[model samples]
Target: MRFQLLGPLSIAEGEDAVVLKPSKPSSLLAALLIHPGSVVSTGYLLRALWDEDQPATARAALQSCVLRLRRLFTKYGVTGSLIEAVPGGYRMNADADTLDLVRFRTLVRAADGAADAESELYRLKEALTLWQGPLLANVPSPMLHRDEVPGLTEERLRALERACDIELALGRCRQVLVDVWEAARRHPGRERFSEQLIEALYRTGRQSEALSEYRSVKGRLEEELGIDPGPGLQRLELAILRGDDLGPAAVDQAVPLPGRAPLALAEGPARPALAAAPAPADTPAAALPSAPASVPPVPLPVLPARLPVPPVPSFTGRAAERAAINASLTARDPGAATVVVLSGAPGIGKTALALQTAHDCQEGFPGGVFILAMTRPDGSSVTPAEAMADLPAPGTAAGRILLVLDDVTGADQVRPLLPAAAGGAAVVTSRRGLAGLVATHGGTVHRLSTLEPEESLELLAATLGPARVNAEPAAARELARICGHFPLSLRIAAARLLTRPGLRIDDCVAWLAEDLPARLSLADDPRMSVPHVFGGALHRLEPRWQEAFRRLGDQLGEHEGLLLSSGTLGGSAEAEEALERLADAGLLEEGPPGPYRIHQLLKIYARRHAREWNRSRTATAPH
Candidate 1:
């Protein structure tokens, strides 16, 4: 199937054009087609469809639109393999040949490296012909407001400029002067179009008029962009004023000014910075053009800003923690980045809290939020240096900025990524306490623990509203209790209840009250169950700590009481250190000179790990 979005939205299979219903689904499908092979989150889609006045049934309505689009593909005899859902959103997988905009760019790149001026002019005009009218002329999509649209709009203008360059080379400058002047008037802030107008005026023997045009554009640039003109246009103005030479290279040098990139464009309030042009895949003997003499010194440095991933809507509680994180990261300082590490157990909401805080504090950072997942999906670690290489350099952009390092295992993993600039801040979430990160960066560390009983119940209510939970107060309390006030387990239980409509709180309570071994195998959730969420922390324990945790679990289960002293830890210093390590990791709660109690579910996980470790050691022991 071929999708045409360069003009009106249309999809065709073979030679037959599929008629799409003129409604939100058609517009929504058009929006998704803008960026092929990329995830467009549900949040963005909703905003696009509704602007600010979203309906209550927006999620369901959006899903219906996607379903209808897929059905339309099936109806047209094309397999519905084009669009699919990702974890957070949906993505379309269209290629360059099938998409008009992509084909246009390919043709432009071919013209950029053509051998002769005639062929270059031909290719440029061919590419320009693809645009029938203003982009997506008949499609009423909210997508026109997106950031990528300006870059898409640049394609036509660039093809026009390249054609003008070839025309000037063919001694047709006199024929293009009127068009160039009109284009320059329409887009006064664009340095290239204005430069073309100046060249045409100079070629027509209006040297003084060309100089006057350059002076006017220069003043506009200073007032609007807070910067001077680029080297290319400035040099052209000088050459015109002095009547440099009517040489062969005169056309090629029209827009190339020293100290700036040849393809640089003037940035306005709505426009992003223009990147240097890419070299052609297959180039001729003559190089296309030299890169910038150096990085173009714009008044404001370009920042590779990215949106922070948001948590699910059910996120609740942690009011104090959120306030603390916001206050620290948003503090007014002109020295070094304020580092705040959220140390907690696995599945204890550390990453979620940090992400939510980053979203909340986004307004404080003009450079925008930069989020890095410290661990890969397969569970391997990413070195700090590798992560640092992906972010903007320290002290490069303006205003406050945030760098969120999620699921960190060690301080050393994020050391290189830490900024030395004062206006920068980082929120690092880790199971292990990053004391060294705080010490080196002069920041604070907050140890995150499980929610309090009221807070845990509130989290459950946030997931399954108060109406349902209030109807079964006893069952709700019982369910929360069995989950040990653990945020991860409560969320999982809520999910089960959400999926099963008739299932009540008592059903969840019965599910949670089952024996540990039997329940672990029977739980419907593989991702957020008690053992799955809490078990990984056990394996992270060192040998001595593992033994202590296992023995402690055994004693707690056997009614040996909650408090442990030197006697229960086998009088071993290694065991004592291991117990403290477990406490610091949020697997155990620390107390003064006694046994540290753990959550009821955590005790079970510890006991399981302890028994497994002992069994392995015993099996390996000499017979």
Candidate 2:
């Protein structure tokens, strides 16, 4: 007899399949099968049977459910003693031959041990094929579904991702398209799948469809999650647009196989020493004696440090900020490590500036340049411990290292990961002013603002060429003004023009002027969207500050270059504090003495939310 838990709970012997009629027995069976070969405690079984509403006879009721499951199994010709009443609990004795879930795991393990890509691909495909649908879809158990189903589903997805990686690596793009398309469609929120789908589509001679799919993904993400596609998806779109050579190597660089360390930095001409060297190959196996178990294991060799940051080829501004960062990082301070915190509004080019600086100062730090993402791809905070583990081992690099902690939420998140080595430095970028970090770490903070007008124009001219921007000089200036001179918005606007060669600057400016923040988004990249980026900054603030920002925008909408005092918004001291906090969060810019300024694009975003809030308030008001 075979038990299948990959999908619906069922029993099969030869060509016959059996389903448990009663929900209790099915739930009990599912609970046992979830931990096949291991004992599942009675307490857990009872909870699974009757979640939060256990009867006085719950223990006895669980036994009765187990009996019903056994009887059903026997009726279906299942072998004897499959469900054993172990001490304090029940254990379902299932092997690869008896359970599809067990078989799937066994196949995956075999694939992990497979000698070649072809063998691994075969085993992974076989493992994936066993998953018929959602885990235990027919088993009606809220407990099992809540706790166990998600993990089982993730296991299947990881396997599917691996299988697709192998297929792409093997140059079977056409073969991978069918599975990738379905995966991307079903899991639109998963950027990795979208990236793979885009690559597969592009590689299969469907470039336009690939670009369209990116736009669809960007739209869905914006509409559903109020965010943009991650850096990976954005980079993939740019690569496709450039018609770059996206062979197997490019695919690996773009998506990276899940669960592995990202590709290491190039070692240049000089190779660093390894942590441990291998034994001489000429030594015979019989002559070599293994070290005692008490002996410490040899550490693995450390590869060259690699920052996953992409180059900013068209980077144009931040001359002073770049010089300050370079001086801080390169200064020979043997007593303490340097920390330079770059705080700015979302999409104000903190990261771009950091990347450009790191590249420029690469020669100063002989140890290496490394990047630690403080936020996960899903936009959740990565714990400091996990971030530390992702770093190269201490003393692994040859000399002083430079670490870039990207998208940091707070000073505390960065404190533990700061380099302890003398002469080392860290460049931290965040949406909020990390004053606490500076207080503790003794570093300088550079608060980034919008680009200068000439700088913004230079960025546009650099990207779209001087001839294009100079042709319609006034229109170009208007475009920059509409973009609020924000680097990210400017880049998005420039990318749009670069793609559409024939679109006139004045016409583009007119289109953006109608709905500045909403139209500032690029179809291919979410991070470039004016509203999306500003929304993230707004969402991070306290509720009161968020409301204050929205209300302030509503009052100042389309009133360019206008300044509002805190007293004007609200007379209370709490209102003043809220305004100060909003300014710290980069949502509002502080004037010389007391007033606050909101960017034109940011004001548009705020006004929209303010209108929404007003409607919501009206609807919820007493009739």
Candidate 3:
């Protein structure tokens, strides 16, 4: 059976497509196919089906879909099981090569690295040949649909761009005119498409046509963005006007722009729409392969401007830590093809550290894609299948993107989205160690431990400065200990200090140590605490483990609880299994050499909440 998600979600049994019942199931199946071989958790499946408002029997619904999928597989003449039920979710048991999308991505990466033009062209063609239509076509899922449309659209654009690149490499600029012109007509507002068309026009000695195309694009930008044409296109126009031979070397030159982007040939200022071009009397407007004259004049829709994600601003401290991260990244080939797992308790700065590393290594991986997943209402992670469906295919500018999957306790749900080591690297952060998944994929793991005392002090100093922090060294140390040296707590504590400009360090420490429940109330920001960030992860734990977490907060040491909950503690394996679940959610820390502890702030929060519940019950009891 061939399952397609890179385009329309289709399941074909040999030569014929199988009919899928319950269209919702087909959509769900499609979402999984987008990231085939990845584990998709139950919670994510529900969300893809119902989002925030899950049906009463959501689990049953998901199981039904799985059943339908299995039946379809059976019809395709597959033997035993195609889907495997794993710890937290389901895994589609197939190699990457079996899926067309995976095959396409693999080919693209190979093409990007190829030295020969003919080989690169063949690779690109192979990649492009896999796409059938808009992904998840006819599917009625909000997240899946939104992602499917944009994601596949981006991939199609990339394939066209790469094809142009290969053509240019072989000195076939003139030959690209037919494809480029058609692309320009179809996507009139896409500056990249227009830029390539102009370049091809100029290279083929159609100087006037190239200048007219540039002017047309300029008009579109000015009308749309109220800005002028970007540097590369403008410069190309000048060179063409001056009769300068803008050979291969010129194409490689940077496009001058006000921003820092290396490649902005298509990211220039948006222009206003031009009056529709009049069709030549002799030529039909829209030519097609079948009946050239009968092809209708199709109006091109405006390409929405893709705003870039804001760059990470300079952050404070941990130079050595940052260097260590960069070293780990650079350790693997041209760089490591491994998934660097940053596991630690909530608010220990795992996400922050990973982001910083990603920021630092931005230059190395030009075409890298960065993604941050939000937790679902239920205690499961967002599935890799769903996430992959949403991610735009890597663009030329964003090549070899560093894939950072933050909050990755649900490895089963996300492992499919983890790209194989091709032209990119992946970093996954979790509260618990995903050793099994990492080992299975031959990936290297990096554990993000709590901050050191010195590092903690440095964080405070950065926020409050050396003078204020030094004024009360004892208070600083006490504050660090109270916060368990977790980066989130430190930042919050430091932020509070910054607000009260004249507050003493002792006063801040006293506030944190004492009256913290009352002072750091959820009244201000609902998600300002570690507990807030760990919502879904916490809910997913079994009841016994959840209870054990609360009870052990005051008693367990960091490593002790970690080992106990990570299934290493001695007992009937079931008890250890319970602990393992807690460890994965960032609720319990399982450090090296044994021991486990909750995030210091989380411990305090849960204890107080439990105490309040107990108090309320006692007060309301009838005598």
Q: What value does the lDDT take at residue 621 in candidate 2?
A: 100
Whose TM-score is greatest here? Answer: 2
Which pairs clash in the backbone of model 1?
A: 231-257, 232-257, 335-422, 336-422, 564-595
Off by over 4 Å in 3: 1-321, 331-336, 374-380, 394-398, 521-523, 534-536, 553-573, 591-603, 616-623
* Local accuracy of candidate 1 as per-residue lDDT tens digits, 461-565: 766655567789889888877776767777767666654546778976886576652253224324445665566666666666766677776656534455555
lDDT of 2 at 214: 95
Residue 48 in model 1: shift from native, Å?
A: 26
Q: Would you list the C-alpha lDDT of every candidate in the order shown?
A: 0.66, 0.74, 0.60
Candidate numbers sorted by lDDT from highest down: 2, 1, 3
**What is the C-alpha lDDT profile of model 3 across 1-623, one tens digit per residue?**
66656543545443334223225676677667666778988777777778778888888888898897788677667878878889998877554446777777788778666655455665776676576533453355777765556775777777777676545433355435545666676676566667777777776556897898888889888898898876777876776688764433111112121112222223234321111121234565466123246545443222122222322221445567678778866554644365677776666777777777876676676554455553432234554544553344434233455677777756685566655335567778877778787767666666666778988887776545565677799999988888778777776676566444557778877876775534542333444565565444555576777666555553444333323344433445655555556666666666335655555566566566566656887899998
Write down the worst ten-residue block by lDDT for model 3. Answer: 250-259
Candidate with more favorable, higher lDDT: 1 or 3: 1
Kindly give the number of clashing pairs for every candidate. Answer: 5, 0, 37
What ranking emerges by TM-score with the best candidate at the front? 2, 1, 3
**Lowest-lDDT window of 10 residues in candidate 1?**
270-279
RMSD of each: 21.4, 25.4, 28.4
TM-score for predicted model 2 compared with the true structure: 0.55
CA shift of 398, model 2, Å: 1.8
Q: Ten consecutive residues with minimal summed lDDT in candidate 2?
A: 269-278
TM-score of 3: 0.47
